[model samples]
Target: MNFVKRAGMSLRARKSRTAALLGIFVVICALLLGGFLLRSAAEGREAAAQRAIGVDVTVRKKGMSAADAGRLGALDVVHRYNPRFPVRAGADGFAALTSRRPAPGGARAGGGGPLAVVGVRDAGLLLPFSYGSTGITSGRGITPADAGRHVAMVEERLAAENGLKVGDTLRVRSTAGTRTVPVEIVGIFADPTRDPTGAAPPHELPGNVLYVPVRTARQLGSPGTTGEAVYRVGSPDQAERLHAAADTLLGAGSFDFRVNDKAYRDQVRPIQRVGAFASLIVLVIAVAGALVLGLLVMSQIRERRDELGVLLSLGERKWKLVGQHAVEVAALALPAVAVAAVAGQLAGPAAGAALPGGGSQHRRAAAADGVDATVPPPDPRVEPADVARVAGVGLGISLVATVVPGIGILRLHPRSILADTE
Candidate 1:
């Protein structure tokens, strides 16, 4: 019989040994496939979280002149920049609309309570809008055309409470009560944390917030009043580089650059940990599987020594004997590898989901970004490249395990083996 036929016969005769080797190959392949899939998913999730949190730097300093804002906006790393002019103002008209009477001495009902009047060229580019913490729900957001106009975008809850709508006028009194700016309500926005039980402070409620053009804010406050400028970078990974660039351009002591990457870091932590653990598991399983399978093959080879000796006595080449053993192991492992690929595809995502710390941190990060929806499941298919990789490694392990012991076939003396067996 040819070496191929002999290999088939050997496998048929050693059913238990063949089954054991097949099972080991399946486990190794399954681990490899699952690990690769999990790592891919983790990386994708980390990147998405980073993008959701955004990469922005806030320059908080007094006297951020228009010239300085212009220079910062021109930086190559800056995707966009919005210089805010925040001031405190009383909107008694809105207060009265909410059915709250004035205080004892005729002060506004909310204790002459000041609402946050934020001035910007474009409300869409501001942190709240950019981070998705708030979004325009009615009319239109502040535009460049409204830069010097008395236009405003009030919060939805505030507008509802005051019965304000688009085209209505909001009378705002400056902090010193010296100037009253009447801004046209052009839009309304919804706050992510609009619930009464939300974590925002009483004074910082979305209902007490208003947006106006930068010029209007200047008109209501000191012309020289300076507010913070926020710069949006290209990505989270580039935040530090952009920070250094900003410091170099604007001078280190002149401005304090605060980069808010905490959300991104927190979200990515669990994914990174899971990825590392999966990698380590893959490595351990591959190495250990090889060692265990090799030893088992060595023992099987020893048990078949008398048979190999007879083959050698029949003039079969030693290398052919080794090739026959290799072919048998390959045949046994190929089917197991295929089954493992399917198993990994079906189970990899579930395995990753079950890993500790994967979901909770991601949810918290999403909430920080004002996202309250369920995250969709990751793709579960095993890619062709991953299958190819597992196959290559599995084959390598099988060859090393089988060939190392198959070498003993060359040392087999037909007379010694036949006499020993007898």
Candidate 2:
């Protein structure tokens, strides 16, 4: 009789053991399928979060402090924070970007309007920088980490006029000449925005603009005095939270907490975190599944020593004995794979949302920033590829569990096996 046919008969004879192993295989396969489905849903949620990051809000208060800005930025709902402090400063060495012709009324003497130096925590979070209307031509823009540092991003045309490059130093003095701050040029940006009427002040020229750290700007004229605090939040819900926080911190009826529902393109950091977690689930289940099946198969091989000896004594080849065992495992694994595919399809939606950054998390990303509507969670459909992946992992687990243990028993002589059963 063919080993394949014989293996089928043997499984029927040991119905209890065969049913137990089949149940275990089905569980392992189901988890593998669930992991793949969850990962797909996470990717969809991340895409939605990217689209949702543009909702913005600005809180304007008189004499807002740096401490207040820092505390507001620390909120999880705030995606990006920019505290703007615009001040006029006198340039020491470099020439400001000026018009060939003076103002129509002829500019007043004494160079009253100094260069415009704006202080910020994250320059990139500002309007011009975030929208690409203004872009860094060289080096990197100032980030939140540059707080308290004397780093700055010089305007492109202004840097070229002074023959300045990154790592060069520029000097700025307060309008009252009470204090001077020396700033290191870490980046140079270009802006096409110009005074259409050419009637703007010298300091207000687009080319003469300078971006410095928030702390550095505080030293120019006002200590801890910011013009306004702007934030990029994922939803209107987050914007409301910011409004409440600002009222508690800056007091009520004094500040203008305005929320702009317009979408602003920014970074989606939480999506990356969600993907990492899905990968961890896949890895943990795969490793544990292999270990469990291996131990069970090894124990079964030891108990079947008498059956193995009879097969070998009847002229069945040692390799065929191993093949029969492999056939039995494959028979169970194939059915389990089918069962898992069905189970995953039925349970995918509920399970996907249950994952981190999935269900209620989707609500934060669902609406059009301010539009209150319930958006359905990303579909975690069990695709053909996902089934294929689970199938491959199941076969791999079976190979390791059966082949490794079978090889160990196959090495013993048939006489040694028969004598052991006696």
Candidate 3:
């Protein structure tokens, strides 16, 4: 109690020094709280995107001709063993049905609905064409064996809205003609983006969509939908060169076609920019934090020179003086860190919500959609594990900041402090 009282009196006597130290703590706490939340949120968002799409590149046949493939194959950066294939709108010849359906006014009349069809010859090459959420979730993705016949994978959102499920049957109709076939629901999906929405009963299709073998797309979506090629380039910088080469091979006549590296470019650009910024911010904060702490400790030592001298003259060991100061600083810093950690937890969600690219909303919506929804993905949320990690990180940062200043104080000599006594 006596020791505590003396320490309190000493702190009161050196109000200016104590206040300066507290100010440093405040700045450190604020900066760390903000920075950690930003870093964690950005990391989480990136991880989610990456998990959703593992493919480095997605190639679509928006603008490819037969000749384009020759040039694409010739690109220097094109990886060997790279796969490519054809994708096209559905055609009657390719729209063979594998399921049975009822006639009008039959029991399962509601089960029969329009299908969004695409024809791909080689499922292996089109690995990027996988499933993600729309407004609803989905069961297993499409497999290579699921090809052929009129087997269908309907989006879960469309399925729920229409009360359709796997093993059900649908009547796929071609808009250009009266061609219709029965397709088995091998899989049900929940893709609102690709399906329907709003006052239209959600399952209504504005027009018919069909998927047949790629050779038949010319008769379906666009008459001009001819052969398109994709070449995987080693780097984004190679996109221009690859584009030029593809144009040369396809001939100037088909130059009206658009070559889009936008998806690939957009994907990589943000990652590079974010990585650079994160590194810069962390580096600057760490260095500045250390320097501020060092200077603050040195300044405090200077201000307490007389106190240090009296301690030494009264037989207090130099190391003991150092230890006492260290203990007091630690006591103050631990509380500051604990408070800051709580502040970080409270701020994390808000920061995550405000994070760019609609991160927070996506997570929140996914959560609200819940497992009860047909299409289900694990909810993106800050778990207790995340909070614990953030707490550890905050305390770690505070520890470093506290230790950095002590480096200067540790360099002081007993003789230098004692000289003030004489």
* Model 3, span 73-141: residue lDDT tens: 556755311223322222232332212333334433233233445544333233233222332133443
Q: Estimate TM-scores for all models.
A: 0.69, 0.56, 0.49
Runs with alpha carbons beyond 4 Å of true place in candidate 3: 1-20, 51-149, 152-182, 185-261, 359-422
lDDT of 2 by residue, 1-422 (tens): 79999989989999999999899999989988888787777777655654445466788888887788879988988878898988788888777776666777785535434588898888766767655467788999899889879988988888888899999998888767788889999999999886546555677678788889877877876655776878877776678888888788888888888776643221234555666777788888888877887788888878888888888888889888778877888789889989999999998887666654444544454332332223345778888998999888888888777788888766967898898775
Structure candidate 2, residue pairs in collision = 54-264
Q: Give the backbone clash total of model 2.
A: 1
Model 2 alpha-carbon drift over 4 Å, by segment: 1-36, 39-55, 109-113, 260-422
Residues forming the 10-long window of minimal summed lDDT in candidate 1: 96-105
lDDT of each: 0.73, 0.77, 0.47
For model 1 the TM-score comes to 0.69
Can you write out model 1's per-residue Cα lDDT over 1-422, one digit (the tens) per residue? 78889889888988987888788778778888887787777766555544444456788777777667768777776666678877777765667223233334543334334577788876766877867777888899987778768999988878887788999998988767877889999999988764444233324665777888888887776446455887766466577776676677767777777776555455556667887887887788778877887788778778777777788788888888888888888887778879988898789778657643356666665666643224444555678888887888888877887788877876777779888885
* Alpha carbon RMSD to native, model 2: 13.1
Lowest summed lDDT window (length 10), candidate 2 = 366-375
Model 1 steric clash total = 0
Among these predictions, the greatest lDDT belongs to: 2
